[model samples]
Target: MKPDPSLAQRNLFLLHHFHNDVAKALHEHMREQRRRGEIPPYRVEPTPSGLPTLVKINESQRIVLHTRPSPLAPMQAIAQELSRQPPGATLIFSCGLGYLPCALAPLLNRMKVIVLETDYDILLEALRMNDWGAIMPSGNLLLLAGKNAMEEANILISKHGSLLKNGIRFFPGRILLDEETPTFTSLQTIARESQEIFNYRITSNLQVKKGSYAIVAGHAHKELLSVLCEEAGHVNMDARPVLRRPAVTQFVQTPEMWWESLGRPLPAKLLTFTNKAFLPSEWDKMKAFGIRRFLWCYDDPFRATVDDTFFHHLDRIYCFDPFLTKRLQKQSPIPVHFLPEATAFSEGAVGPPPWDIPSTLPVTFVGSTGLQRQDDRLPRLVSSRDPSYLTIRQFVLDALAKDERIHYDELMALPVEFPNFHKSARVVLLEDLATFVVRLHFLAALVNTPAKIFGDQAWLEPALVGDISRIYAGRNLDYLRQTPWVYQNSKININIFNVQCVNAPTVRIFDVMACGGFLLTEYRPFTEELFRIGVELDVFHSHEELREKVIYYLEQEEQRERIARAGQERVMREHRFRHRLPLIFAAE
Candidate 1:
């Protein structure tokens, strides 16, 4: 068999960008088939539209990849099918000849599309028939080829868990192989199960609104926002439906039931922390009920499977990270604004406990050590054995370890190129790994110092390497009540920003300042934009600087008091949750 230049180029491209094991397996299988003088299972055919199509040749039967003359005919059907479904991730059982993904590329802006093929031979034939360079690098399309449907499904869940959100839709390719029947069936089952779980979780958090504004968020945000809204004379309602009820029972009163329970006049607006608060259908119902939907993303949107489709339901989006805000503005039709996290405390909010100068800790840090559950996330990248991912990970870890001040945007925009390295979930994983490294590097220096770490037993792990157990405080702190007390009483509160939060100070900065505590925080590009560097809140550029600041501030009690007072004033005047409400509702 002669080596076709086009097919060889395509195979090489696949090997460069995709999983090496799958590409190598296809190469060896094709070589063995050629040696046996066996014809390829699929052959390319010219369509009347001057486009190539695929035709599968079995023992005595011919199966066309598409029945219509134009290769795009199947795409029309797919588009029509998609029009009826709600916005979310898509799961295709098979790739067929790769035309589906290729044709759907323009429509898949930020949407996650997973292609699972049971037969590697068919996948190999598809790779040989088409050029996947454009679609492959977009990072939205994932191709998984495995021995069986169950195996592929497991891989999909393990690697791309974010895509399994509530509204995921499953589709069998137009030309499904006999071997792919089980794949299609099993994947549909998985999708159904995922939807059920999502429905339960969303419905479990459903509340009936008493105020003109409804907030759907995690426990902390929900409590904070509820208080803020009510304090502003909104009389916010706590719409708890039922407590500790089974999911089976919760479904009896569907999300629509709660929405209808809001009575004839619905809330003036609905504010949700993330897209996970409601189902696609529920979003539609809310939109139909004339309730404006606004989303505030605390996490980096790029780190999750959220895409443009998810934004279609939202009227406005406020992102905590500036880098992501800019990225989302370009990709989403909705208005994307930069809104940093704010302190929940108001101007005259009372502290949980009276501030005691004598009992105050010298230095305190409140947050997770990111090291916990670190191993669970590494398996996906490690198992792939992709040198590109490994190289990028090591490069980032080394760069961050050398200089903790290296900006996340700099790492992301590094000039060094690797084929399709940035076009996968590995980049997100790299962000997490970089954060852990920077956090460990800075926190380890505080081992001998008087800095006491709170939250997560991971600090006591071997990574910190000291009598960290003595410094490790309780696992949890009441965010609304106790956290403010800790921040208020501490002499110097330390804040370490996650790398993924490129140019923004985290909620901890605002919280500590709101509590009138002197803060020594890691520097961020936008730190100056938010506060006076030395007057309001101090920032440290290195571990040595952090330690020096800790010692210096501990001794200069008057200086600490001045800075703490300034920070508290700045936060109460401009960085409270009440201040954010106007900016959020202004879009209306």
Candidate 2:
């Protein structure tokens, strides 16, 4: 009893086009059933109505899928009932031989059609009985089966919840099992909640009138940029003042309140520091409201899980790294540009060295260890499994464990064999590992020296080789206020670049220089291009070079002061937030 070649081809087509986690589960179930020589639970038989019908083969009783006199009557009745409802997405709880979905085929062009079947056996029988090439390939149909069907449905709702605003109709189909009743009820509850949320969103958007400009960022970024925009007298091309707003993380209540406070006037040009600030539907609403959306990728885009859905909503994208910018420009249609990060303006004018005998501390570093442990559940790898089973997280940890100092080129060259793993996740894992290795390698050298490290508790973890307790300062310094003081007070401030940032100097370099602190930074081609090495700022390419520079700079007070002063002058003249504001606000 070989599997039918036509059924195999149809299954391949459906799985390939409408594939998801649920589909994969269903596929594996079908494969296992075929291997075990178990027949599907349902059988097809011709009826007197001239249409084939499905019969559930239960030991207790046989269940007919359609009415006796006319198998098409129930499907026609369901279609007529659907016509009375408002235009919106359609969700069918089960598919019995594909009759219901096939009858609703003409409606697929107008709305999304989602078919959820709890039993994989029934779905297989339906696939084998009918040709779904017309409905499945339309890009509007989503067929979900298996135990986790509810989870997949929730994801689809989150992505396209706005469509439910008009109306949502549910068809229980010709057959509903006792186990599937709960799933249908849960979907109804989710759709109702989503509609309520969208209603609130619409009301809020209606209140705002598009006019001025606003900045959406994290608390620290929002505060820093708001102050800088005021101090710099930032204005748009029309000479209208660019108004600044507070940071918004949730898309619901806070934005509504803020909009009301400002007399409900929406900013014509909205600049957001991160895409995670708002949900995808909120982006669509803002676009509908005539707000031109802009995003600045201060960190690597991969670190944020940025995808095409987010990219398509943005009008312009600015990135810090040249290599990433070029890569994104090639992949996305959005106008991507390279814009280096700049430091906030110093509160007051920087003066000469404060200490007569250079500070007692030889050097100070204020940054994260980048070695924080992740709580993500790593996919377990069974022995003798295929390489494609390896997830990005597992692959990264294994590679780093073997050689913590693996070259970036070698790491990038390694194949990402798993097709299910996303491109962003791959880069993010690599970036995290690279940062951990780079920071640990350089910071390990300072364990012997009198360098004070200000960061989280990751440094004191037993995994690290050296006893860093003496140098590890508690938690963090306030980036806005305390960081500058520490920079200005220290004899030498060390700046280590994360490997993820290919050709861009970290903001630490600019901030240290702006505070008139002698910066001994990691050597990067962009750093050398921006400032004169050893003249404006000194750089080190290796651990030995770092230690040598730190020792040399501490011993020479005159040379340190000369270089620090020159760096501060350059930063104040060219690298402050004021200098970068124009480019950010410039029209395409």
Candidate 3:
């Protein structure tokens, strides 16, 4: 009455199918056999550098893999089987389609596999269809959800109901069974009973439900990882390693060197919020010991600064201009401040008016000419198609091309010209723009000349105006002192623009007068409030008036020198950074 030995072996395999012992034994045996040279090794070892160590095989037939039925290595063996499969042949899976993907990964792309989803476990059925897309390349795999099982799988439809496609027919009634059994048990019992009695084939649709529940289709990778992890039953199966941290925190060298160069005048400390847009090598060292404010510049309006928890630790949020200031004020978790920009001042004054004709005739301007409308040289747009003239754009383009980081180069290139003035006469230059000259205090030194330029255009275009000059790509301040215009003219000038009425006197005018240059500038209503027109500085209304004043000033040498001297004295006395620096440093 004893059972046949072959039948007993088959029963044992069936009973131990979900236990995964067969898979573990097969994996260990294969490794040992390969080491002993009993079988050729088919797998590659991983590298220390995290790169894969691939196995080199010239022909597909050379591949041999250990495949045994186990819950732990289900996908591994299935994938191995897929590699050896021939195209267009269908491999019928007795288990749910879910198990087919991991086991047949290698064949998924090249050969056909038809999955028969028996009505076994609802969770297994749900899990199997999750990563069905990975099997898509193996276009040979078809999922058949048998007719009667379709209604039973409706529970899946309810949870992920929206993913259902059109034309699918539902089964009639639910299984009526003992309530004491586990859900999976009841499902399997029903499945085996139906297969034996009615010869029913159980399976459910593998197509993802569209529209409302379609999110599942896109999450195939995540679901596949989850399934692999669950099937492995590995409490500590970590495929990816944690990122390594350096043993030492590196410190930069520049700030310390700069501090040493600056001597004791270095404030108790310094802070700089910077962008890669500027040279960080010099700034990086300075940031190590002193306070470092890191403000990453970005043009994307939708960037979320709040998610950057690191920004809140900085003291002052330094930006290149007020526009950046305004943008940061809304989202920045720190106080924002503007840093004054630097310019090289040409050495010496234009000298006094001559006895006969003046030496420096018509003033010259330097800078680039761009699209007529989009340049600050031509401020007004003649047509609707014109874009605003902004020096920042030029600065960005030049910086990108040259990989240089010094700021205000575009402003340094302003076009300064004596439009209608006599060649021998003195003329004032104006350079000041709201967003362009973020800090205007540096303009204090250029005020000593008889004929100085004023207004936003002067600072915005100092090179052309003769206020500040530099040799191409030179970083030395001495380049400004070397320019010819520094010694040829009667005096320099200063003035603010109308757009800057809301703010105080622009910095260029202040710097000009402070530098002992002559001052001749615009006639703003606030000009008189700050200084006497004839005594401290000369102001003109129209272009014609500016021409006439230049001529008159050249004739009246003493009067021009007295006014220039007085303006320089007043600016140095009251308008220096020492007097107004406190208001700027206060916490807003």
Candidate 4:
């Protein structure tokens, strides 16, 4: 088969040589071999500060050699050479290694192909021995096997010493091992065995040294030239030193984290407020631009735990409930914004109503109710549950029994003291929010729809079940039956806590609303601001009003639907995490 015209025209396939003593020695040897007629004659052409290349051929039949040539450059050269070659030109590969396909396959149809494999077993054995304890146990073995298999196949087509006569060279940078370095010797022995087993002879003088040029060899002139194009540069014989230095730190503290005691970036002027994740509406608009920071004032801080890192990193602080704001205002160093706690539309509005509920239903109340000793709650014994109540009552009872003071009925008949105290003076609240939750539950049951109270087992065990459950169910004349408002049947059921906030319209409302039920919620500032009293949500004062509202809303569907729909829109729009995330990340 004829070589490509351009390749044929080029004379002398010079296997690139590096600027090294070994390359000089090899060049002189090749020249002597040519003179002795042991090999084809070719002229040496030195590349400028580059690896030695096979250069100058007269008959276009001289071979050039390279070992482990750079894969990228060779592949490109092979592809280009194939493009110029005539159809049916025979292109023989002396080594059947994996790398050749990347360079040879694209030109396969343009030429005839032949492979020559050398001793295969030695290559496999060599690879295995060297790889037994290497860090990459699996990968090294696979690579070794692949190389051995390919080289073995090469031996079948080519003569035993054909490669040596054609040309054989090592990549200069490849470190050969010596006895002085046991580690190096180990590796060299492995390579030597692999070469012998694969039927490729290794030079007895092959040393554990660093300065060797990457050499590629081929049997044909065209193939030799193709490999020559891959030689990049001569091996560095002088040896270079590596310098190490510490890296400089690049840290930028965002403005939000200013008071963290670490220097922080200047705070941006924009401000944002949210209790939960950023709102989607706010996030979407700001995502395209650089957002500065956000402030999240979490309410129900006791019940609702949050990642403080989030608050610390946020630009400012935000609290929905006034009471929560007051408690945390001084405690937090960040500026706090008090957002009114609003009504959240429960699942009912988004999905189908859980039950057949009218706009106006029965009276309802929902809040926490729990027991504690009065001694647990006093100014002196703040941990006590109003010790004054018990202390005063016990004292009067003792005095009445001794006939030394007014009797129980006489004390009860006395006018109530400071009934308007709550209106006149500020009172520090200390009770757990769960107690309020139970109260709201019964209040809802009494007012709007038959109360569907939702809380954890703790709430049910003490407030709804056991003695109370038997009294309501078995007695047939329960607390509701004795009261003016009565729950028709098993309409009231307690639910577990879905979210944290007590004032916020929780999933209980959604459960009821989805069932087409109404929601009678606590009097939160947000409820009044976000939802109309007669339309979206019904606000309650005391347990009595809660009961009345529940009954009124139950009987009034027109009013209930109006408020439910409005509340649903508000919750889905304003309260959902998706809707709120943007506000969370918003620039402050």
The model with the greatest lDDT is 2
State candidate 2's TM-score: 0.55
State model 2's lDDT: 0.66
Instruction: For model 4, give the 10-residue run with minimal summed lDDT.
Output: 243-252
All models, RMSD in angstroms:
16.0, 15.0, 30.6, 33.4
lDDT tens digits, residue span 1-588, model 1: 122578757655555445444554455455446546787677777778766667778789988875447766776678567656665677776776666766667656646676777666667666676677767665566566655434645534432323455366766655666775775677677666655654555445443343466555432243565566664443233222111111111222244443432333456677777675555676787777667889888878876666767798889999998888998888898788999888776532253454332356789989875533332224334336446445655665566557645556666664433344444555565565567556766776677888888775445545342455567763446577678778888889999877777888788988898888888999887888888999998998887888888878889999999999999998888887667776776568
Clashes of each: 1, 0, 68, 126
Please say which candidate is ahead in TM-score: 1 or 4.
Answer: 1
In model 4, state the lDDT of residue 434: 26
Error of 4 at 474 (Å): 15
How does each model score on lDDT? 0.65, 0.66, 0.35, 0.33
Off by over 4 Å in 4: 1-297, 302-314, 339-429, 433-450, 462-517
Candidate 2: residue 217 lDDT (0-100): 52
Instruction: Give the Å error, residue 470, model 2.
Output: 3.9
Better of 1 and 3 by TM-score: 1
State how far residue 323 of model 4 sits from its true place (Å).
Answer: 3.9
Error of 1 at 263 (Å): 5.4
- Deviation (Å) of 447 in candidate 2: 2.5
User: Candidate 3 lDDT, tens digit per residue, 137-197?
Assistant: 3334343333222332322222211112111121111121233135434433443343342
Q: What are the TM-scores, per candidate, against the unseen true structure?
A: 0.56, 0.55, 0.30, 0.32
The order of the candidates by lDDT, greatest first, is 2, 1, 3, 4
For 1-588, candidate 4 gives per-residue lDDT tens digits of 122344311211111111112122233333334445664333322234332333224376543333324423554555565567454322122222223332445554433233222223222212222221211111111111222323322321122222122222222111122332453234334434434533432223212222211111211122222322221121122211111100000011112111111111212222332322232333332333333444444435543334454355444665655555665665666666555432222243232323444332233333233222111122222223244334434444454235332232333333333221232211112222223333433333342234443222223333333232221211111121121122111122222221234344443444343333445654544556555766655665444565565455556667656665665565555544333333332424
